[model samples]
Target: MATLLHLDSSAFHEPSVSREVTAIFRKEWEDRHPGGTVIYRDLAKEPLPHLTADGIVSALAPVDSHTPEQAAAAALRSELADELERADAVLIGTPMYNFTIPSTLKAWLDQVIIVGRTAGEGGSVAGKPTTVVAARGGGYGPGTPRESFEFVTTYLEKVLTGMLSLDVDFIIPELTLAKSQPQMAPLIDAAEASRAQAEQDAVQKAKTLAERFAA
Candidate 1:
């Protein structure tokens, strides 16, 4: 049985465009795999703490901890690692805030990307595949006005691949703000449609890889 860890970072709930698209993808995934289980984590609702200097030191410390803070930090690292260890796949719903992911989500990333857990001193994500669903308010793909504003995708791929050693699949919904403006719905709709198409394509790719691995 494949276990999927579903993470949502958008502060917006029902109306969050990113979550909307991710929800669709989640439904499709569940339908395709009837017995698959999904573990949902909402970063916006339950924000994770950023890595503190003390936390770093504690994480590097041996399990023999006398201080309460050190013990807590060590426990936190282990818990986060266990989450990744238990999951067969990960799905992230991200809203582009300030041309990047939400701060809360970043906090969670800090916790999970621990040096001996998700990766070692050499670096590798010894877990499973991670799929990201990114939502942007404006056009920011290959050749749009905001094409240069692709820092989010570039940074995400590099960090997830370089630091975590995880296979990544990205699906971006561009021009998400278009529908809110009467003059831009058509353009946004087109972008959204493309995003939806990409989701299906990515899912199919993942399913193929999964089946091949099972075989």
Candidate 2:
């Protein structure tokens, strides 16, 4: 049976666009693979520690030389990497915070992006299909005034593709705050349309991935 590693980092619960879209993808995935396993991590609820200097040193040092604290940090990193290594696919729900991913998500990435374990020639999750649902509160697509401010998807793409060598796909829902913010009221229609399209694409992508991995 296939195993999917699912990560959600949205602080907001029901109202979060990223979470909503990711739910669609998860539903489709579960429907396709009823017997498959899903390793779910809600980063917002259980935040990971940011990489500290000690943790970095421990990751590079030999296991036998690790201090108590270093060993604990190394263990956390290993656990995170092991989840990715065992998964056949990955799904991430990330809402843009100040034009980038939340600190919770970033912390998780720091824990998992180990050198030989997940980044180099022997990367465990290399070439695995990874889908990222990136939700932005404002419009930052190409030609938009804030286009250059969009860093969430770009940063994730670079790390997941450039570093880990994963086959990454992005599903973006823009202007998610349109309905909630008075200043964005006029853009609500466009936001809804974008959300609908993202949901549809996520479902289709899930089906395609399920079939590919099932085969």
Best candidate, lDDT? 2
TM-score attained by model 1? 0.87
- Judged by TM-score, which candidate is best? 2
How many residue pairs clash per model? Answer: 3, 0
C-alpha TM-scores of all predictions:
0.87, 0.97
Error at 33, model 2, angstroms: 0.7
Question: lDDT (CA) for every model shown?
Answer: 0.76, 0.93
Q: What clash pairs does model 2 have?
A: none
lDDT of 1 by residue, 70-97 (tens): 7786678678777777877778888898
Weakest 10 consecutive residues of candidate 2 by summed lDDT: 116-125
Report the C-alpha displacement of residue 5, candidate 1, in angstroms.
Answer: 1.0
